[model samples]
Target chain A: MTEAVAIENLSVTFTGGSKPVRAVDGVSLSLGQGEVLALLGESGSGKSVTLRSLLRLHPPKRSRMTGSIRVAGRDVLELSPGELADFRGGVVSMIFQEPMLALDPVYTVGAQITEAIRRHEKISAADARKRALALFERVRIPSPDRRLDAYPHEMSGGMRQRAMIALALACRPSVLLADEPTTALDATVQIQILLLLRELQRELGLSIIFVTHDIGVAVEIADRIAVMYAGRVVESGSVRDVIRGPRHPYTRGLLASRVERAQKGDRLETIPGSPPDLTALPPGCAFAPRCSLAAPQCREIVPPLAEVGPAHTAACIRVAETV
Target chain B: MIIGEPAHLPDGPDRGGPAQPLLSVRDLVKHFPVKGKGLFGKGAVVRAVDGVSFDIRKGETLGVVGESGCGKSTTARLLMHLIKADSGEMVFDGEKVGADLDLTAYRRQVQMVFQDSYASLNPRLTIEESIAYGPQVHGVSAAKARAKAHDLLARVGLEPGRFAGRYPHELSGGQRQRINIARALALEPRLVILDEAVSALDKSVEAQVLNLLQDLKDEFGLTYVFISHDLNVVKFIVDRVMVMYLGKVAEIGEGPAVFGAPRHPYTAALLASMPKMDPDARSAEAPLTGDPPNPINPPSGCRFHTRCALAEPVCSVQEPPLAAMEGLQEAACLMALPGSGHSRAPAPVEAAA
Candidate 1:
């Protein structure tokens, strides 16, 4: 399989503040065509920052970014303004958590989708509108003709999300960047959306980077999962390995903290400390303060993400000692 | 009249009486008027909570699970009397709640904790003062209230010395939530309404707060109306569950039974929709099809027919009453009832290893 997206030594630092905050540390990731990778983390973990960097969504004046990003065999950072605009929706598209906010309320859903298609390809208005209708039907919107004229406010949350996905797919991008697309939706609607995404990915063979804080959501969607903490990828592996038999203490702590794993009336095992401040991180592993298996060596030297098992890597020195 | 839990109702032979429920809501309804299109035009009504009813047993946690605009929060607000119900009866400890009800006595017995930690508490008031303020208004002396607040703060695991004097802005989300819990319990309420109380906290912090709530319930003999969209949390903490769909009760039963063998299509769909924690277990198909019909003009009869996969022609025209299923489970669906030709055998609860 060809590599759809590859990132090497990516770092993002906000220099506008008095103390420069490094949001994304030296992180590296790669996703093959048609593969879904879930960047899982809590707030301030840089999972979102890492995904946003692919599109260069940060303000260049306030943020200093150092990275080599290759998507669809093109270097992302080296793209000119015109090329970047073409690359965004033509080669890659994004969907957000709140589709209503992402969608323009003033215009009809069809108008926005047609505009996206027209922006990427030189087409007549009628042709663009026809393509937009096809995309809407492809995303399973009922009464495609009627829905094309409905504004964002007129549609329900689930319908609005479907419209967003249709808009994202309007340009037929190979890579999709979804940042918590289902986070704000209800559970039933979330499942519907997740299923729709999985179907679209398989049918279209699109490489997707799904960012979420919910581990269960990650398990449902991703083939491989990358656990982020304090701007670093602490663990990277297949979803089954990362969830059932996690080698990293942080990953283990996260799985153990779930209420489903514990019996009623039992005290849930917690990580025992707050997430580290990215601006004032500790010397070694940022998770060391909360890891129950942390030792003197863990606090002194940073543990590189090393292979613990076949196709699984964990950034913990004590991975061997764990079962 | 109290809609008694007939299926799960405890024996009444000993005292010649089944103990009255801690709180009972009968056909409660509340609607807000939408803004008119023109100055002289009449406003439309949004049926936020339409004829909802339930009962909370003493010392029991009744979990209310629903999607957005499903009236879970509105039910909580109604229980706290934060908003007046347009029509229906509420009985608290056998006393009717109404305009003539003693407001102070009612406030002393029921308290609520909101979801947003940063917005819920007063920024100007210190943690201790905020917790003490509720009790002070209910006739407790300021000094006594402060002392009680300090003791309560320690009970919720916040150190009085470290947290009591700090303002709301100084504390983290988890700490502020703990303070909120302390404030809710300051009046020693019998029933505490928690509306998405732990939804804002991180997983670890949420676990800690949930455990704390469990311990506090046992110690204080308190009942909780736990309202949240998270099914997993509700399954872990609540003994019984009530599933609401578009301001109507879809199903209600013991947690294990309700989750294990959901009778209502909506309940089953909700259970199937939860992203399974185990990656190996993936749902075969989308259980539900569409968004819930707009509540402003909800579906003619059954509000869930628009989304339910098993919805028949009759489902959209005739409303199904909440009928008994298996054991203590009750579901409002014609498909699950006998003589509907769709009555399937109930799925048994999986035995834990």
Candidate 2:
């Protein structure tokens, strides 16, 4: 069986400024059908960049890409301009962190979803409206009929996000890209949306790539976890392995730095330094400067991902069991 | 537990008289009028904060938590005087604000650090200049202010020599937030209101900043009104926790009591809403459904009744008062008090429990 999404050595560099920023560097990832893979990282870690590359969403004038991306059996990188446009939303749809900014303010929520459905298929407006109402019901939006006519601004934050999910799913894409969809919401609202997504993913057998910096959210929704740092996948494994037995020094630091890891009134263990500059990352391991176990050799060579457990892989020579 | 009593402070430079609360707010209320709506316009007022009252003790971190539009930020802004309140009274160190202590003097005693570090600082100013500007405006000598800024820079773990001359744009988000903390401290404030100050940082960076804040609090004997939506962070740092819903305090108590055994249904639901860190223990069902209701003319009584799992008919008719419970905890729930007309309320004999 073919994978829902496959990426190989994806390198994306933004070249607008004098010094180019290698946003994503030699990152490879794959997701099976109906699997939920979380691209976990802090800001500037390039998780979002890798997700966007699959859709060819970057500005052509400023960004240069040099890697192959395949999604749902289509060669994303090889697709023509027009075909790329068709591939977007028709085969792969994405939901953003902020629904207020993502949804069209002028159009009613139902109108937007109906237009999205009509955009990919030759369905009548009436049928599309019916489909849109069904989607609203599917996402459990209150008062589906009244909510359909309400504009994005008229709805509350959580309501707006439900509409966003309805719109994203309107085209019936096999793969979904969720970029921190719950980060902007409160804990109560976040869990509701998360549960909704999990139910929908299972019900529809949809493959999903979720990008978020929040570990708890990742643990709640993702089956596989990929920890990114300095534009590389430092660790990737089942959620249990990554969270319970994090191998990468950066990933370990991230887990230890959380509030629950420290006793009350105790100083939280930190990574000691900020992320490396994307434009001027060190020649070897970018995290070596801040890593506690860094040795002389660790700074001179960039470690490759090696198997630690049956399914776990980490990019640190010291921690890699294969060595 | 009430919202009307005003405290009296003794006239002196010494802050926080022997048993006095560092700051006390009474009947704090703020209602932002909607566009094209007058003060008396039909349901025009967005009751962002309605009659919130609390006391801040010296040297303790008081956390303010709630969902968005729950009036957490509005309450902070009112405390900071960033926005005028419709009705309220504040007593700082037992002295009534505006009456006993002037606005400028009151402001000097209290400082605020916002979430957006870059937007809060002046773009043209260097790190040292930004920190020193507060003291300079308050009539401190320029050289002394600069000297203090350098000392604070070192204290916050930023080497003064390296960071002082750099502009805001040159520093990272974590570094800029440190500068904001330094700026807040330059005035020698007794109370600091950190409104989601660490929310924007990464886990690693947030840990570092939180440590810095704890150290600063100890060194300066600072009282903190730490407002955030992250319950884990709040449970870790604050001595006391206040849970707000629809601009009203639902629960306020010692940290352990509020988190371990909450009396209010809203508080219980909020605690349950936290996603467990363990992957195997993912919650099967959502804690509470539906978004927080709009602030405009919120539900008739007990603002949380609409979504609360344990809400009864009385919850929508009569608002529960903040009844004092054991362990110095207070909750505005009918179930916490005996014979409050709710079937699930504690028995009169069990009221002492």
List model 1 lDDT by residue over B329-349, tens digit each.
888887765554343523333
What TM-score does prediction 1 earn? 0.93
Residue ranges of candidate 1 with Cα displaced over 4 Å: B1-18, B38-43, B99-101, B336-353
Could you give candidate 2's per-residue lDDT for residues B20-137 as a string of tens digits? 8888899999998788754346658889999999999878999999999999999999999889889989998868988987787788778999999999999999999999987777
Q: At residue B85, what lDDT does model 1 achieve?
A: 90
Best by TM-score: 2
Q: In DockQ terms, which candidate is top?
A: 2
| lDDT of all predictions | 0.87, 0.90
* TM-scores of the models, in the order given: 0.93, 0.96
Classify candidate 1 by CAPRI docking class: medium
DockQ of 1: 0.66
Residue A139's C-alpha lDDT in candidate 1?
91
User: What tens-digit string does per-residue lDDT give for candidate 1 at A181-246?
Assistant: 998888988998999999999999999999999988999999999999999999999999899889
TM-score of chain B of 2: 0.93
DockQ of each: 0.66, 0.85
